[model samples]
Target: MNDNHSSSAWSTYSRTVFIAFAMIALGLIANEHRVHVLGILPWLLILACPLMHLFMHHGHGGHSGHSGHDHASHQAGPVQPKKEADDV
Candidate 1:
């Protein structure tokens, strides 16, 4: 049913948002304090992961049909043939 479908969609969306926020939170915490061991690198990397994902996945809306061509140039009449004057 439509209701079930919508519910599932909402749940998925909520989960994704939660995970995104959690990643940011962890990153912020890591940035606040330095870890003595090599583990800090991995933690910072984890924080950057979500940002990379977002930028890589962001979508631009579809383009209109007019984008590819120059409408004005097409509207102009075809080039006229040039007549050469006869040699005197």
Candidate 2:
């Protein structure tokens, strides 16, 4: 029931934290061999940049409200509004 679901969520969270820490530890070990790593660093970055740009920005998503218009240079020069955000 509720207890089972709560325990399951906690277990998943704990496992995720454990894996994150393990990765940090592995990264530190790799950093110790940074001299060897740096030799391929530039090549890795050159390859990754294009791949990430292509994959990550593949989808143009639901910003349908945006008309792709540049209304910055309107007939009415400028209008500054009051602060609308409520205090937290």
Candidate 3:
């Protein structure tokens, strides 16, 4: 049982070390290509707008169901002046 516990601890330690190394490598690579990344940042933002719009509205069913959305239904015919009690 003690040996098994040690092996598990070692496994966890190795995994953590591997992740640390991978992050360091990725960071270095990203630093080297930062200029290229910045160059494409604007295009990425533009592309994300439409992609986000499509995905964000997907849950509530797109604009097709909103065809009846108009101010006409909300307006109670022409407004009439209120009659004064004194006039009555």
Candidate 4:
């Protein structure tokens, strides 16, 4: 393992880590100011709902309703052999 190569590889991620921490700090600060934040909460919720709907539920939304498997004709119970006593 080369020391310089490992350092250079990880150095590329330094900015991403910094940005992630900055966003977390900003969220914490926003959380501290709940009175002001509450006013914007409604709009954020409205905006987030559709974004979540579109992004999170894409698995169900994008696919055609038909998967290859048929559901209706699936057997639910065990098949019992005709009992000898039932015919009477």
Candidate 5:
């Protein structure tokens, strides 16, 4: 395999492993102690980052409604023949 491909693959693998470890650590910490007023909000934010990123970046941009208006103008308004059948 090319070096670029190998490097990208390794990077993706490392990112996945890092996220997994973070989630596991969060779960362990949350489970071991009683919920606290200060920790609650921050923990929620930490858990929500992935979902917020998914929606803000990946989810909304995939919809084509924003570009559909451009397509409407390109369509032929109506078919018109140069000469009527009676003219032939």
Candidate 6:
């Protein structure tokens, strides 16, 4: 039982050490690539605009599927309110 406990403790300790080293390595890599990443940030943002518009409009059923709206009906005349008897 003690041996099993020791093995489990060793595994957890090794895993912790590995994760710490991995984080340090990632930090170093990110620091090294910071300039390149920043240079691409603008292009990434520009690309994101069309992607966001496509995805966001998809969630709202898009512009092509307007079921009840009639475009031609709105073109005929300016809307005038009915004259009430009290107004005259």
Give each model a TM-score: 0.32, 0.30, 0.50, 0.31, 0.32, 0.60
Better of 1 and 4 by TM-score: 1
Strongest candidate by TM-score: 6
lDDT of 6 at 13: 78
lDDT of 5 by residue, 44-64 (tens): 899899988877775343356
Alpha carbon lDDT of residue 11, candidate 1?
A: 79
What is the per-residue lDDT of model 2 for residues 1-88, given as tens digits with 9 covering 90 to 100? 4655554645777989999999999999998998988899899999999999878975544435646655554435668988898889
Which candidate, 5 or 6, would have the higher TM-score against the true structure? 6
**1-88 per-residue lDDT for model 6 (tens digits):** 3655553645877989999999999999999999999999999999999999877876443246766665665446987999878865
Arrange candidates by TM-score, descending.
6, 3, 5, 1, 4, 2
Give lDDT: candidate 2, residue 78.
66
* Each prediction's whole-model lDDT (CA): 0.72, 0.77, 0.80, 0.74, 0.71, 0.80
**Candidate 5 wrong stretches, greater than 4 Å:** 6-10, 35-88
Off by over 4 Å in 1: 6-10, 35-88
Write one digit per residue (lDDT tens) for candidate 1, span 1-88: 4655553645777989999999999888877665554667788899999999878765433326436555555567988999999998
- Model 6 spans > 4 angstroms off: 6-10, 65-88
The worst-scoring run of ten residues by lDDT in candidate 4 lies at 66-75
Q: Evaluate model 4: give its TM-score.
A: 0.31
Clashes of each: 0, 0, 0, 0, 0, 0
Quality of model 5 by C-alpha lDDT: 0.71
Q: 4 or 6: which has the higher TM-score? A: 6
* Global local distance difference test of model 2: 0.77
